[model samples]
Target: MKIKSFEIFDYESAVTFWKSIEGVTLNESDTKGSISSFLFRNPGLSFVAKDNNEIVGTILCGHNGRAAQIYHLAVSNSHRGQGLGKELVDLSLSKLVEANIPRCNIFVYSNNCVGNKFWLKNGWDDPTTWKVLQKQLDV
Candidate 1:
């Protein structure tokens, strides 16, 4: 397995895989919007994983001038538990370090028990570092 930056040619396939994730709540609009912005504005941190010829995972890492964040880390269902997630994180963080950046953050969906535990077990948790909030929209 290897992680590399995504190509726009992958848009259709990536969106198909992403939208099928059970708890990810992603749609084409979200991917199109966030991904296009990231591509033009912050290309370095975004990545994808390939298992030989297939794209099995993707991650989008971001950095402000002061801190870094990893978002939208997803592995295709068949490829889970093979350590691809950890590999992706390590790769992304390495890029951040090369840029002379420190202090990183990642948003794991609160309801995703597997992701929460994985981060905790990896010693990536700092309780005081992040706070979660929700803003209800008038629908």
Candidate 2:
């Protein structure tokens, strides 16, 4: 398997892979145009793992001038248990470090047992003192 920078060309396969995962939710922000803009803005931060020219994993990472955020980290079921997820994360974090970003965060649904377990086992903490709130704005 080889890891490569994510481009808009990779979107279709990446989205398909994401949709196949149980915990990943697709929304307006994940549209092709939005993801294209994101990749343009963040550049080298996102990545895809391709094996034999097929997308097997992906990580979408970006920073808002302060802290970095990771989204849509998914690996093909066949590729799990091979540390591909960690490799993708480590690569993103390394880029963030190079850019001087201080911290990184990810959102995992409370009901996503598999995802929650992965994050916990990987040393990600759910801060008891903080809660995430959101409001969808009409465009």
Candidate 1's C-alpha runs over 4 A off are: 27-29, 126-130, 134-139
TM-scores for all candidates: the values are 0.82, 0.97
lDDT of 2 by residue, 37-64 (tens): 9999999999999999999999999999
> Residue 24 of model 2: what lDDT?
90
Candidate 2 Cα misplacement greater than 4 A, ranges: none
- What is the C-alpha local distance difference test score of each model? 0.77, 0.93
**Residue 64 in candidate 2 has what lDDT?**
94
Q: Candidate 1, residues 1-139: lDDT per residue as tens digits?
A: 7767876666677777777765556634355665777666666777888888677888877787688888777888898888888888888888899888888988777798877887897778758766978675553
**Which ten-residue region of model 2 has the weakest summed lDDT?**
112-121
